[model samples]
Target chain A: MTKSKPLPSLIAVIDIGTHKTVGLVGQIIDGKARMLSFSERRTEGVVKGTVVDLEKLHNCVHEAVNDLERVAQRGIEEVYLTIAGPSVAGERVKGFVAVPAHDGKVTARDFNEAMLSAKRLEPPAGRATILYMRQPTMLDGKSVENPVGLQGKRLEVNFWRVTMEEGNVRFRVNMINAMSIHVRDFILASHAAACALISEAEKQGGVLVVDFGAGTTDWILYFKGHILCAGSIPVGGEHLTNDLSVALRISRDTAEDLKVRFGSALHRETDANQTIWKDGDKGVGDQQFNRGTITQVAALRFQETLEFVRKDVLHQLEQIFPGHAVKLDQNFLPSGAILTGGTANLADAAEASTNVLGLPTRVGIPQFEKEAYRKPEYAGVIGMMKAAIEDAPPPVRRPQGTLAWLKDMFRF
Target chain B: MNLFTRLRQFFSPRRDAFMGPADREWRQLIPQDVRRMPGDELGRKRAARSRLPLVLAVIFFATLGGIVWVSIDDTTAVVAGNGALRYKTDGFYPVPDLQRLVGQGKDGAAKDVAAIKADLEMDTQIASADVRRRGDGSLEIILRERKAVAKIASLPGSGPMVVRLVSPEGVQFSGAGYPSEAIRNLPEIIDYRTSGSGDKATIEGIEVAGPFLLAAQSAYPNLYREWSALSLRDCFGAQEDSPGSNLRVAVRRASQPADRPVLTEIVFSTANWRNELAILSRLDLDGLLRRPGITAPAYVLKLSIQNRTSARPVPEPRLVPATTR
Candidate 1:
């Protein structure tokens, strides 16, 4: 918000997921984002949305950040954190008030009141919280999508608010900042996942964001420009591979490789002819799994997990906008579901998800025109960086007030 | 009748059987050998020594007559533009500077005399020049042209180059300064090994005039009539340490207009004048001129031939026109 020109500054992101921790440094050079350096390492001490070992998690974040700093030739000051966990929660909250009769002018204070009323929902205990809030519609005696620069008698708000455990976010930020880097902003993984996969129009046109991460799947439904609902399922990509290893009695590593390289989630044309080569182990000679058998085993696990996710997403959508006759495959949402996250890379997952959920679907990679984000996996981290840069107050100002309010409106 | 008649003619002795009266006259022409006195050997030796000049005189007269006949009959008047402007009695006439040979004059001795006087004032070095007529109507020129022992290439834009003239002896004179004219189109001898203006050069022992003369003599031997200009540039010698010790001369061809050789580079060592001449005789100047491929001397006439060097195609011998001016 500083009117003074933004100096050539760097923004870094540390994405510490259960499977991997990645650090990326980007510079704003000549008004364009340029990649300065990037580093990634396998993560430990965290699994299934909870930190099992805090010390190990700290070390993982430290090593990746240090490498990024060295390669970028500059010390990292702060990092935008990407948070993904099962305790995160979302719901649609709306508020409305009659416009002042004499003045009939809806001021900035009125907008703030509506948003505060929406965040009034108390979070459950033992879960620290971070908020993703948005105002979708304004009804000043009439339902309007844009309230800005409009004269109105009454202002009503339709907004989506997501709350997650604040302790986990604080820990993640504090861990990175402990290495002398500040956590500029914390972005809930699902929203960052959604930003990477879907476009602005899809959110307005009713789309589902299914982020299939390790040990969990985060699902959010968007319709009419607001997140109608969000939910998480415990079964994710790791569960499917675990089920394969247990049922087939193979090594975990082999099960993972076979699942990725020879995995199929649907009975399709290519699946009919597919043959998976099984390296001889455990006294079993080299063998092959025909397409039908491999699909039977893989799809049995993946399909059931997807069914559970589909049911939750559908139940939430119906609860939010009742009597709207929102069929899972209804044409009201021209664009269907957008599936992202690491596990969504599985072959035919989109088709399998569409088949189980009875809706169209496609896999999504984070799309960034910024040169720093040439890789799609870094989408969540970069989204957080952008969010931090936007939220920071103008360096010359009091660091509070309407400019900060204006900044929030732009946040994903 | 035979015996008495024969005896009668023999008695008269005018009718000797083996001798005709004309033959007797020829016999009288041959004097009889006289027997010398016992101590006359010493006297006769002295006498022979005294008569030796008379014997040389008879032979000298005969040789003189023959030489005169050959000079008068064989030598022809050459109406060249340089020097006294008239023909030399001996074909060997000197045109100090060939460029001055350009001018028009009348047909007879009057015109020749005018050309002579004009030429006299032109070159200060010329002591005198004369035009003499031979018996065969060929003019003999007795020219004491300025002895510009060195020749310099004074071509309009190029720097001057020089060459040494080899006289009766192979030793070169390093006295006279650089000559700016005679070696007009000679390839300059350069030692690229050195820096600055260049090493001083000369032609034919007259220090300044020598280089131009050498260039003229050497290049003229292989060049055609169209020669326009010459350059003398020093090139790096094959050896590195002993700089200024080894040098070579490069000759440019007249038919080619470029100062540098466009066809072939011809290089010959200064130490091998005779060898260079030998190789020069083998150059087919006329053939090279006639061929469209021989564009310039750079590509064809490579004089840098040695035992270790690969043998290259030698053009046929050049039959240079015998105009020596």
Candidate 2:
């Protein structure tokens, strides 16, 4: 009889947002993701990335996972989830350790000791650290890419620590656990987006990634191939829709439709004379409004959101490198800012970002083999899968010996 | 609690205290990425509640499928073959012979696999038959045949005498497909009383002699090759441990003439035959017969008597003249 081939191992990820919850199941074969199945559902009981009603959110998340299982023909036991919103924040901390070797060579053990010392700093009250990103290592007094085999008396390292409120994280964990699925690890939304959209060259040249969701804006700053800072704000596309609804005396649904169809982030003088109908057909409920009015309302909200993010980035930079004369210009961030997420689909979004942040910007769409996955909204979930594969431990190779062979023979 | 009170409790937000400096100091020793958050008991309970219906449905359907499968007749679709019988055996029984022995009907109809298995096992020679129906609509069978240790002759009332083979278990059956030379080589049991006929026939004292012969045939082939016939006249059936109850085995003469006397018969007590057999296996009979002494044509070896001349009694075999027996 011929032996049957074994099936490849699959990885599953879920991105829970204020507007929608998405589930993806696929296999990472030879460092490339092969999509198997995907499902998404409208979110409820959540506002601005915070769980407000546990039962309603549980129903939404459970249905999405069930649909994915049906299509993939497999059940998901654990998943990598995305975390965002105002409760998430980052801080930079430094650690120092003295070299113990008589030859004064820095070993792997010294590097580990310095890392351990750096992580010893705790988050503020009622918050817990969720992730740690290592920066450059310093030997003696100079920064070195690798400290091993180098001579140094004192070893120091800097780590960008990310923390979140305990109560908020618990709410998310409880919601997912209610569906009989475990949360394996939490990936920050901005970090996941950067992994999907930012290339190695872009990271090496310094870049900023801003993910504009429906209810929140998360951004991460990468300088010299290391994460300098990351933060989130409680303002997104929904705020713009709310602004248009109040300004034009229309319902929220009609306002959203108008914002998607005729809205622009940069209003032009010629748009003042142009008129557009709410509904394409001249039906009884259809109404006409000046095209300029739609652009004006959307631009105000979009620019204010970008300004807030820019101000936050500058403040964090000042805190990290005080009196270093840092600036958000081409000299520091050579690759400029890359915009992504669902809200980034707005017309002239990059233009608005450049006008406000004073840096050249462009919208980034996640590139994938499947055309359906190459959209702004899929960047977070796709990036989450990539992060999970990159963070997984390497496969262990067994030693070939008589004892090992005997153990294998009797394994069954 | 009242509905209002329960509603108030459920909606109330829970505030957790921050970790102290001591706890943080110890936690920092471990890598932050590998650390996991505390478990949620209430969430786990909710998950168990959600999985209950799915688990129950799977179990119910599995049990129902098993019952339906067992209720159906498995042999209704047996593939066409020679008498619709397929079997393997280590003995000399052929396919057609086994089919005839199982009594397959002349009418071409599928028979129950269980019934076929039972019919095959009914024969005295077959120890067991493993019957199964393959997925391709064929009946598969494996048979383990019993080994014959000795032969016997019985004369029913006014009928001709018939020879039958005896198994190690003392069961007698017509040895089918056995070579004539192999059958002739087996020693015959003479002067024994039997109570039954056909495959169920029972010898009066075979229980004591069958295993003794089998043990010698397996462990001491050189000595067993000299045996020609066995006599059970002195053995008492059911009361084998009585005083002086013994079995006599007649030995055949050798083809070549020897200077020493030849063994005529070996006698053993029924109660102590196992110990006597062990002692007999260790004795150098040929060497003893060729020792310097008076010569005789034939002699009888008696191993059932004990030598009591010493303080401790020891059982030993003694040689006597054939005329004394």
Candidate 3:
């Protein structure tokens, strides 16, 4: 008799962005992600990554999930969700514990105590921490990757904690629960994008990742194989479209079409003399607009967004390393910056980022087994899958003793 | 607690403060309202699909439990028979006598099945007992009785002498329900040592003598019929390979004619009794006694002792005059 093959472990992830919501079902086979099904629908009732009308968003999300289940032929019980916006931010905290061993050698227990102490630093009032990224363990004022079996009088540890507004998380949880799917985890959008688009070598050599969505911009900075900071700003490609719509005296739809067709984040010498028609065929009510003006409007807004991200990174760095002076240059970040997300499709986005952030920049497309998923727009969801698999928690072990067993039996 | 306070607490959402490095990332943020609310059509369909396997599992487990319950139920009747206790045996144990042995009352109330089986197996005549309760509130019992290998005559401290049968495993039991001719045909054990009293009595050295007699009766019945009594005076307990241990069987003289010299007794070594019996079966005792020079009225056959003066100890049956033995 032939042996039957075991079924693959499938993971479903959903990215709820301002412009569109995407749902994907995939499984990692032999260290490569095998895409099973992909579905996306236009988002509604959400603005700047905050839900305004939960019912409308639920309808859209419900349809997208249904489409995924129908094509994949598997029911999703829980899903990893990617969260972004102004409310999601990162902060650095430090904790130290005195070595208590008789030999004065730092042990795993000392390391754990230091981490626990660092995590005890509470988040701002209405937010909840989602993840704790460890920096490095310090032994006697010197940084060490692993402190165990090393002689030290004190052990110090630093963590970059990511927190989100508790109310926002609750809303998303309730929405997904309404569809009978539990929210398994909340992944920071920038973190997920970095996991998908950035390589380990780049992270080790210090790199920056910026994801430009429709209504929000999320960015993360990595230096010396550790995350320095991550934050999201509520300004993105839609602001550029609005800027064009208000300056060129055109409809928003025409402005969006022009932005996609002719908009550029960098100005060219020939843009002044060139003109682009809203409708190429010159149909009825079609209008003409200066290409230079469109490029100027988009470039200004894009530059401003990148500058904001640059300032945030510098400020966070200054706070982390108080006495040291840091600069955003090639020497500081050798791997430069990688740009991804839907808005990264704009022409010369990398050039604009390079100009504004003072680092070599390039548009990042996620690598997948399937050619269809290797696109800038799918980076966030794909990264969410990767992060979900890599950072999956260990299985909970049942407690011993009769009372614990009885309690477990009665637990729903 | 007040109703309003309880309601507020019930609707409150779950919040996690800080996630340490050791904390799990996949813990759910459950809200009371979400858990209490019903799901959509697709969720309902999925739930229904999941319930199918659970239902089948329940059905399978229920069937298994029912079978086990029926097998161990003491009140269930034996459907094959019309009584509370159904006795099946190859021996002469009557139902009433067996019930009395197991201490069952006449009212036929249900008793513990394990206790009844243990009581039945305690009897010396029974080798094994299987007692089960059927689905019709009756007990079904099947018994295996031990066969008599030889007879032992014992005189208790306060009773008349009684003749009991010995099994191949050295168990002594009253030869109940056996034909008088069959009992009389069995060779009596003499000069045997025994311990204990009554039903628990065990004969010493019966381990060797009992199996020998059984083997002779089974494989060499024609040679076995001439044996009258067996003496274990030289046989040691559980030491069948000892050189000095031997079993002596007295030959019946009634079958021999008055004018002819007859063989009286056969001696077999305990160590190689089986081989000695096989050799004795092939020998023509009448022809040997009729040799021209033999003049003794009775001769003793010694099949146990070997001639050891040569390089190899060779076993050869030797006949000696009864007076010399």
Candidate 4:
């Protein structure tokens, strides 16, 4: 059946990062998020999600937003922003307290105190917190959905924390404010994307999300419907392109073109007499080069990236629980891992990730209407929109007047 | 030595100490000459508010005056013939011919705008036309022409059948001002039982059903290709006895496997075509061909009888043999 689309109010969301800038206009129809327009351009005057050159950044954002407004045939006044930079980091805090001393059922105040104990901290001098998620509470020795009426001695609450550099965020916010648009909220891109790529069942069973972009690779861990860790690495797919450029002795633009058209993360047998596209007297797309070399370079870099990402995740887990010896393998994890973002489209990227992490892995794409969710790159923006919809205030209820009351009393 | 003081000191190293927060380097995007006119603070403020509209008004009046002067001076222009006109203007009658519109044997002020509008309205093809004088004194005509809704043949004429293009406003044209594709592809309204001299009067339901046919044809051309004709015999009245004969439309069905075409008549209710087509779209017509005891080369579907959704196909009568086989 064809889905019915009603006229819906539009909401704008922007993802400004190191490699590219994207603007999206979305709407909520029948409580489902739908994308109306998508516009993207190369990053300008920005480094690792920080505004470095103000004038150039202004022009870049103005052009991106203007193009989206034209495509959607509307104006944008507010935006939901996504942040992915080196300064973004996640921490977990666990608080424990006795249930109560009295006989009356453990009051809601006791539960609130237990949960807020872990949240009572000033963000470090220049850092600002973005999100705090609470996991299912532990009563005595077992996890319980609600422990108010149950008899228990011990109550422990765990919260996942995400924070970023305050000055950097404010600078970008100031720039956006100058353009006459309000910033609704800021989210870590990987944290927001976890909502779109991972299902509730997978989250309850524990899953890992790895988002790969051109300049940065972000990872987030969620288990039991709550986040545990999230972080970003400085290196990403750009390193692979740079590696190919140097190894082939070709320009960066040509290397990128060749990498996309011929490169694969899985190696295959090469024909000794066969030659593939390389520069020559022939025109572009006619030039000849060795196809095997392209795949080899891609495979080698992918192997290195998988190893680095695995080590990073393992190291963060160790820090979260110093003495527990958390195993980063299939034996400990049941839901496995989901990969998303631009680099997830690389051939054999999922297989290489599985091999390195020792877990089942698959590429992740948002589950929305196909026309809107055409690519995995939209996972972050779509997730942010879902988050916005959940956060919107409820509709107001009007009071009935005396005239209506009289009419009901006089009904035949 | 305290933490707050030390943290403040560490972060404050050369953080644009002298310049204010609002001060940016690229604030000067305007050229030097433009900046010179609004050099000082008050002058810049005044120029920004006052000089813009003054400059715009000067430009607007200057352009408007130039066009007026050119149109008033030119005198050699005149309305051209129907050959020079873009659309078909054949058999012009109540619509004055080109000779009258061009004001032959009349003065220069002849052919005013209202007269031209009235003359154009006399014909069925011209819906409405906005006539204006161009900058070079020639008549500029922008027309909203009447499109052919269906090709209808109602009353008997000199030929075997009188087929004319029926417009949306329920007017007939003698095959004028329409392209060949329109004449060929428009729905055929043949075998219509009505009487009149084909004046500026309308038979009911033609205008209403016209839109539904156009929409159905555009939406489902492959399905529309199956129907050949519609016989409007007492279509306006409610039918109690012979409802099937009240409204008739021809259709073609293909027998499976052999893919042989069988022509048949389908009787349907006089509802909107879209609604009736929706009912037809949901019907499993092919499933009826394989029903028990159904063996016939061709048959008629009585759709108007029962639940219109379930059309019953009647098998053709077979001639019983006189001799025992």
**TM-scores, each model vs. reference:** 0.49, 0.63, 0.58, 0.52
Q: What is the C-alpha lDDT of each candidate?
A: 0.57, 0.80, 0.82, 0.65
So what's the TM-score on candidate 1?
0.49
What's the DockQ for every one of the candidates?
0.00, 0.05, 0.08, 0.01
Task: Give one digit per residue, the lDDT tens place, for model 1 in B20-102.
Answer: 21222211212222222112233344335445668899999999999987655534444553322344322222343422443
Off by over 4 Å in 2: A1-9, A74-77, A98-105, A139-141, A151-154, A174-182, A391-412, B1-325
Alpha carbon lDDT of residue A27, candidate 4?
67
Q: After superposition, how far is residue A210 of candidate 2 from its true place, in Å?
A: 1.0
- Model 2's TM-score against the true structure: 0.63
Residues A1-412 of candidate 4 have per-residue lDDT tens digits of 9888655666788877666778888766777766778888887887644567987876687667766766775556567788886877677767777866677366677787787666665455456566676666888878887877777788878777677676666666766665555566666798777877887888888888988877788888876776777778776777778888998888888878877777776767863245676655588555567877777887788767777778888898898778988888766668998888777778778888888778899888887665655566778777777767765532223234686556544543
Question: Model 3, residue A228: displacement in angstroms?
Answer: 1.1
Which digits, one per residue and each the tens of the lDDT, describe model 3 over residues B1-325? 2344335446767424333332222232223133423366755665555456688889999999998885666543343335666667776555555766556446776567898888878878888888887577677788889888788887768779889888888888876777878888889899988788777777889888888999998999988898999999999887988878989998999967777788889999999889899899899887889889889889999998798999988779988889753
Give the alpha carbon lDDT tens digit for every residue of B162-214 in model 2.
88888878898778888888788788888898887678878888888888889
* Residue pairs that clash (backbone atoms under 3 angstroms), model 3: B76-B137, B76-B138, B77-B136, B77-B137, B77-B138, B78-B138
Worst 10 residues of 4 chain B by lDDT: B23-32
lDDT of 2 at B172: 89
Tell me how much of the true interface, by contacts, candidate 2 captures.
Answer: 0.03
Candidate 1 ranges beyond 4 A from true positions: A1-5, A140-142, A148-153, A268-275, A279-291, A368-379, A382-412, B1-325
Sort the predicted structures by TM-score, highest score first.
2, 3, 4, 1
Please give the lDDT score at residue A182 for candidate 2.
60
Model 4 stretches with alpha carbons more than 4 Å out: A1-9, A48-51, A269-274, A279-281, A284-287, A370-373, A391-412, B1-325
CAPRI band for model 1: incorrect
Among all candidates shown, the one with the greatest TM-score: 2
Q: How accurate is candidate 4 locally (lDDT)?
A: 0.65
Q: Give the alpha carbon lDDT tens digit for every residue of A101-137 in model 3.
A: 9999988889988988987776776676677887867
